[model samples]
Target: MNPGLPFLPQNEPSGHEDEGEPTQTPNLEVKLAGEPALTVAEYVSLRTEILKLIELQAQLLSLALLSLGALLGVAVQQRNSNIAFVYPVLALILSFSWLNHAHAIHRCARYLVEAVEPASGGALGWERFVRQHPLPFGMLGYWGVRSVFMGSSLVATLVGWSLPHPTLLTVIAGVASSLLTLAAFVLFLVWRESSPKQLKVEGHPGSTA
Candidate 1:
């Protein structure tokens, strides 16, 4: 059992797992204090902005990973053991990138919870959403699917670099560049999908300036 969380009551009189467990429920409320009161369209606008931030953050993560891997490979060729040393630097980069990614998702989720429901409820509810939604929180609907494309490009880059030759750096660059482009494309698509819709909001829900 994890030491940090609250100790659960014995689930059963016989000390069984299900004897006295506390049942958990999903409570969907995502409101924030600083955020403007948003309509559905405004909420979607924030979603679009957050999508761009997420896509950029993901690209940064993949590139940072690929960077560490390639630097190690290059250092290997140069007989430089310092390649191992720089891994910590790579880790720092990764941590920052991931933190940014998480922040972006949190921003989007905050709006969804707060915009849809005025009250954000309690800590448990926030924790529940965080766990269930994980990284990208695909509830952004179609935009979340873009992760697949990004993941694919990153994998391709890594595979190309895994070859047993120095020339494979080209492939690695290709992979990183491709993922970067995909990230750009995701942002473009999000803005494209959202901006026009924002314009045509004659009596529509969530329309915004």
Candidate 2:
């Protein structure tokens, strides 16, 4: 034996050693952003209100279409082809109004699907219910309503073109309708593009988590 036992090797501090610090869990604050977390009942009620709004939009569209038809019929009976331009003008207005309402309905439905359903954690089925029982009218969905209006208007315009006594007013009507339709479509595109990528759920200020 040299001195005490051979020289003992000393323990070395390793770079990978964990310092006895407490681990932290990630913040899982699942919130609806601008909107407060709503109860299941509140979600359901809001969904119902949206559905009612969609129904009202449909009813208003129907009334507008009926009025347009009546106006056309009266104009024809009175042999007033000079007022032919007025028909397209009215159609443009009605179509724009209808599309605006449709957009509102779409926004509400999207909120229900994206926010409401997710928060429900499989408890809410309002999205499915709305799909199963859609709003009244031939309106099946977003594209369906848009197509219906565009298609019907095209047919009506073509028919008007074939009418007797095509005057300057007729041409003016045709041009105005086409321009307004284009304008409305452009505006819709702008609105969709300018809309926030994230959905902001409007909620009471007190509900912020």
Best by the lDDT measure = 2
lDDT of 2 by residue, 10-126 (tens): 334454336654322232234543234465666867778777877876775686577567756765676554344355556566666766765676677767766777777767766
Q: 98 in model 1: Cα distance from truth in Å?
A: 2.3
Model 2 regions more than 4 Å off: 1-38, 128-142, 181-209
Candidate 2 yields a Cα-based lDDT of: 0.55
Residue 29 miss distance in model 2 (angstroms): 21
Best model per TM-score: 2
**lDDT of every predicted structure (CA atoms):** 0.47, 0.55
Model 1's TM-score against the true structure: 0.38
